[model samples]
Target chain A: MLEINHLRKTFGRLVAVDDVSFTLQRGQLLGLLGPNGAGKTTTVSMIAGIATPDSGHVLIAGRALSGDTDPAKRRIGLVPQDLALYEELTARDNLRFFGALYNLAGGALDRAIGAALELVELADRRNDRVKDFSGGMKRRLNLAAGLLHDPDILLLDEPTVGVDPQSRNAIFDNLEVLKGRGKALLYTTHYMEEAERLADRIVVIDHGRVIADDTLAGLQSRVAAAGSPPANLEAVFLTLTGRSLRD
Target chain B: MPLRPLTAMVRKDLQLFFTDRRAVIMSFAVPIAIASFFGSIFSGPRGNAKPATIAVIVVDQDESTISQAVVAGLEQDRNLKVSRTAVDDARERVRRGRTSAAILIPKGFGDAAGLAFFSGQEKPALDVLFDPSHSMEVAMVRGILTAHVMQAVSAEMFGGRRGGELVDQTLAGLDSTSMPEDRRKLLRDLLGSVQTFYRQPDRSAGGTGLRGGLTMPYTVREEAMTAGTNVAYNGYAHSFAGMGIQFLLFAMANLGIEMLLERQRGLWKRLRSAPVSRLSLLAGKTVSGTIISLMTLSVSFGFAMIVFGVRIQGSLIGFLAVSTACALMAATFGLLVAAVGRTPASARGVTTLAVLMMVMLGGAWVPTFIFPAWLQQATLVVPARWAVDGLDAMTWRGIGVRGAIAPTLVLLGFAALFAGIASMRFRWEEA
Candidate 1:
């Protein structure tokens, strides 16, 4: 239930995201796929209200999101590209703080923190400081912090970028469970395999422009009709965006 | 604008701050250590109200009773610490800064000075060797030595055996001088009157005796000017105020650096993504920073009171008013640093230099009264100056709420100014 319509963002002379559009529906994972510096994060930032777009707007559940402290922002949980957890605080404390930001308190906040920790499979280590945790554990706690408020729409931006394979699989399983619970997720990643395995629909973009938007099979058919049948999603992405190495 | 989120942020910051044991300890330790050192220096060793004594070395080469009496007179003066040594040792002591000055009575000085007094010829002067660096002490010692030397020489000339011999010699020499007969007779009459005065047995009471010679015409009755209050100046009060304000700025500036770190580490972006407004976030930081600064200042002053006898001699409510305003000003200054800084490293360096300059100019290391008129007037704009002055009024100055109102209002004005600028300039994320 999230919509980004013709979003455009610029930094001085450089266009970070231009004429980009996407829709994330309930119980569906939409992968905004792109190579590095291809405006995936910028588009996610615009939809999450972290950055204002030069044009266009983001609508959450049919209401236009505006201003820095809009009520619509409470419906969207953003898992940033970086680990934003306080290293000195315990995992539970970090979750409690994030939960409180959404106005959750008392027993409700406690339950929210407990459920978020349980979902991330960090319940046993809730009292441990984030600094003492492994890179994988910190990434998981970072994901749990975003889900503490239980928002309808979750935005994950490269959440498993540097996580280990086990933690990545754990995060994938958590997202699958969230999708099963009717959560709308906007997952942005450059990895074709992650998009192929998780997203129901994929949107491939390059240089601030969307190149392809279709189902996995629909993308292969388009590649097949173009003369060369694609072997996988990677081949489909390469044919659509190009084979040039992105910085 | 929601209190839950704002309270959560403040709590998180305080938790992070207190978790670092070393930083917490150092935040309190540095100010107390520096304040105690300065307090001891200003208050003397035992906190007595006595002024500093000038150390002087006396080289008495004349074995006469008059020279001994001069040494005794200097020893009796409470202002000078007199010590006897050889001429060469005395010079070495003065050169080495071991003593402020040296008083040297040359050989046959008693006899020569006695002769000069009666004949009115050029008088033999005692040699003074002094350290160049201690010019003030040397000047004071010169004044004190003049009083002692005159009393001793005049006492011997008034009634001692040396006075009779010197008068006879002066009369005999008067005849040999090339002068008019009337003038010679006038000089002889003056010498004959001196001999007649020297022959009196009761000269010790009213003549040029030690107690009656070179006496001050007026006496000074010192009193503390505290607007009729009985409060006395405590060195620790000023020292604690100065050091407390200095370290509190450092501690608050660290809050700015912490904010910059949050920006670098992506926490700011994450927090901004939530429904929290920028005003709420900044207010959270200010609340936490102000609380921590208040704690730091309290610990410093508490230590000062326990160990150095510092007291708040004015209105207690006024003291709290100024202290709270000062803390709030420091908190807003921290926000200003974060709003203007580009990065944590550069912000730390620039804020450190800025804080040190402000503290120095505000007279944290020394009293503002010692500063030049231009510099003292220029420092009036610095917030630290107002903080220290306010604390001083609340402690030693014995100024009640009336005196505290201006400083508290000025500090709160600065707080509002910093908060306004920070709000206008603050960015949600790094540029």
Candidate 2:
């Protein structure tokens, strides 16, 4: 449902995202695992059409995202790392606003807002201003806002950052529901456990390149054959991308 | 195209605006407070049109009839209150600003006039010493002295001539045979007219004992549409309204900065991810800013009316048209600032400086009339000036609806031009 080919982005002297490539099919949850400054955000931002790449292309539903940018944007949803909800507006009002941006209105818009809020378990608190909400609650609302238009592809950029354990689990559970409903998701995170548990296919990225691309079990098998402790995704990740300060 | 999102954005902005109580007070209450305070000061004591109080010190060195008459004249003027003092005290009063002017009558024993009449010499002068810094007071004192001197000289001449006898002697002098009949007849007519004028009682003489003539050398008659209403075209009011309009435009910049923040926070990304077009998002922000500006302007004018007793003598529709255009221009200006600025701080710095400069040049703090001729000519480019002039022409100057139409059109032109530039330059996301 989504395709990227040899994506390259450079900022003056530095190559932020270099020779990156990946693909995701329907009902599949793909995990893009990388450390800080691994160009995970730059890659995701390119897919979301927020940033333009210097070379290569992105395709959503067989339509080139770089060529037909607006159509590609319409099919994709982005849940950013930060809770980008308007603090002044109520949750329902925020949902309504975003829903309308997708040209949803009247009864249809109202129902879409209601359903999105319900899915995030924030339906009861929909009338409360986001400024009054807790950090976890705000994150949930942010996810709900992206889901309001029910796009085919969802791009989540570290959605669990700063969230409590309970809220983190809730977000994982919600992703499971989306997978069950045949939705394709591009999830980026540094948490190996999260990737191993949720990703149907894992793409371990380091220094803007896909170093390892396979199922969690297959990636672990490679590490075990190399005299590792029947390594989990974490040991494999550490083995492939050495532990060093990235700042 | 998307009513729902636009409405939602506007609602969100209003919610935030109201939540920040300080912003609310600054936007609405501050203008009213300033207007009320300034209005009271300009309206004068108890709203009565009394002259501003000025002190006058009298140095009665002569202690003669004419000097006493001058002292009495100053006291009776109502605009000036005279305080009797010694010469030293009078000089101290003038120096200390306790008195605006000091009248020093020389001790001539009422002999200066007699000497001037008999010996043909200049009279002993009344020296009116005043603070040069108080030019208005100095001018007033000079006028009063001139009138007193004229009165004393006229009375002395009339007393010496005894009216009819002097006229008869003048006619006899003109009776020489060398004089042409027509010339003698013209002289006789002139004398007869002079005698008649002297015989008639002076209309201004009964109440004050001394007649007051025109004090100011030149008269400036303000020709306005309204004939009867003595509505002075207060440059201050025009300036206040101009500044008010410009500042209101600056408030719209805050709205635009908020829009940029929304985009950075992924609100725009999410909205774009929906079936909405980028155009719709931009439109929503622009509309919201315009609406807020218009509402602010309405509230400000309402406050102006209630506090300053300002009236709009032209068509209400015309006034609204100009206001709507100005609001649109302001909103467009905000969009341009947001498009150029990468962050809220940058936007604020640029907008604040830009708006203040515009207000100053647009004659918001000072009337364009007071500006240098070249500067006044230069203000034509300022949109704020057009807005202010449109309001003044429609309301204070009583120029009617027809007179405001051209200015309203100019404002609309600015709105269109600014909106076009902003739309062309605006970007939804940071590079």
Candidate 3:
């Protein structure tokens, strides 16, 4: 379970994340939807314990993340927007290193790495260097690295952003497996379809504030009640947030 | 802090270090290559590898025992090659630079030298004909000869088992009948104290030794720690130490740029997100950088030794301590660079300039002795100055543990200072 309570972050006068709050239950995936500069990354940063929130706090289970590398941080995994894998290292080495950060070692770390590689369909190329891998392979390996520690709450910030279709589908499949295993996840993406297909509940944020939070039908009905009968998640998003492009 | 993550982090960085061919070459191969280039340039010429000697012609016109002894002493010293010749021929040899200088003992010089040297009277000058181009060598040779003369004259005048007796006997004959009582008393007291001091050198050694306290001048003598040493100066050794230090500093500072690269690439963010303590991550990076720097310096000096016979001539432990201190200083320098510069591009530009300036000012290229007096003094502020001095002290100079202390302490202080600044200025993930 993950809880973000009224997190507010500001850089000078520009409010990056303002009064944003959300929660995800076990086995549920909450898709965080926002346009450019909508504070998706900022909110995830607070949850990942990388950035300090100006106000409010993030909690894993019932324990809040007070500072960097707290006990609560061990329960959370963050797959950043960038492929945060060491290009100079092999996939297995990358996984082993990330795994050891959570006190995983020996056979346990090895097994976790093997399971992660298998989950991401990268077991055969695990020994190959990440730099030598294709863009999709690196993306898959990045996802696998975050899963190496077996955290209860996984945060995927645009994990499929430059990945190929095959890798994207494999990533979706991996998330479904995590859901089946009763793990909580928060997936942020620009693709409305990814949110519609994978997320149990959708939370749409705009300009640092949560505009709408509901299931696919609940969001469609909300947008439809606003005088526009939206057909899908994309129309629901445009109707709720307006058609203006955010830079 | 958990060691597993620390170990894993250092392992990952070192693995990345070895895998990156450019980094590996820049770290190890570059320093060794540059050291080899300098080492070979200064190793020697035509397989001899022997330093050029200063030539001096000794014309013993006096032909007395003392004059012949002076000639023999010059011939015995290895630093100068002596040839007996006529006064005219000796002067010609000096003019042609075949000899650094000529020492011509004029007729009656030996007999007149002692009293004239001490009692302040005119005596025959030991004519020294020297070449203008080899002024430093000429000066060195003259200094040695002057010291030898002073030592020799002192022996002849007031040295030996009965030397003190000789002074006492001379004082016994002092004309108290004509001189004032106070003046005669002062002279007796002064000479008595001088006799007591020189005769009791062991006692003097315990008090005011290097402070120039009433000790006999010109007691400086050449002691050859290494036998059969043909060269006066080991050029290869100085070059190796200099080049090795400069490159090691450069490599260490560039390693800080590598950290900037990690930050820019977002890999540092991932590491920060891990359940690893910040101290562990920082310690891991610092340890890795220091280890790499130590390895780089070792490889460079090893090549210097194997290829050019440049080896440690001082205390081995002191040399190692000095080396570790330098490595620590360089690693902390990288940390400081990482703290100050936010981006790799800006860090690289600034660190390169700063490190290069340090190297140049530290006398890693030109010998510091050749620098202007003020510049040489100013270079004391540069950490690499201590590094080069430490290596040079441990090598060609053959200075003992005492010589290593200042450098080791200074470098360690620099390490702490840089590390302190870096810790103060650094943030794992700056918002």
Off by over 4 Å in 1: A218-229, A235-247, B45-51, B62-67, B108-136, B150-196, B199-201, B204-211, B225-232, B429-431
lDDT of 1 at A91: 94
Instruction: State every prediction's TM-score relative to the real structure.
Output: 0.90, 0.81, 0.74
**Candidate 3 clashing pairs?**
none
| TM-score quality measure for candidate 2 | 0.81
What ranges in model 2 sit over 4 Å off?
Answer: A66-72, A221-225, A232-235, A238-244, B1-4, B18-20, B42-70, B76-240, B306-308
What does the lDDT read for residue B388 in candidate 2?
Answer: 83
Q: Give one digit per residue, the lDDT tens place, for model 1 in A16-53.
A: 88898888899999988888899988888888787888
DockQ of each: 0.60, 0.34, 0.45
lDDT of 3 by residue, A74-139 (tens): 788888888888887889999988998888999999999999999989899988888899988888
How far in Å is the alpha carbon of B195 misplaced in model 3?
47
Which window of ten consecutive residues has the lowest lDDT sum in model 1 chain B? B207-216
Predicted candidate 3 versus true structure: per-residue lDDT over B113-132, tens digit per residue = 64354333456698888888
Q: In model 3, which runs have C-alpha deviations exceeding 4 angstroms?
A: A225-229, B40-232
The sequence of per-residue lDDT tens digits that candidate 2 reaches over residues B88-193 is 9888878887778998888972456533432234657777888878987788878776776555544433432332344455556566536568876875787677
Per-residue lDDT tens digits of candidate 2, residues A93-153?
A: 7887677666678898889898888888999998998999988889888899888878888
Ranking by lDDT: 1, 3, 2
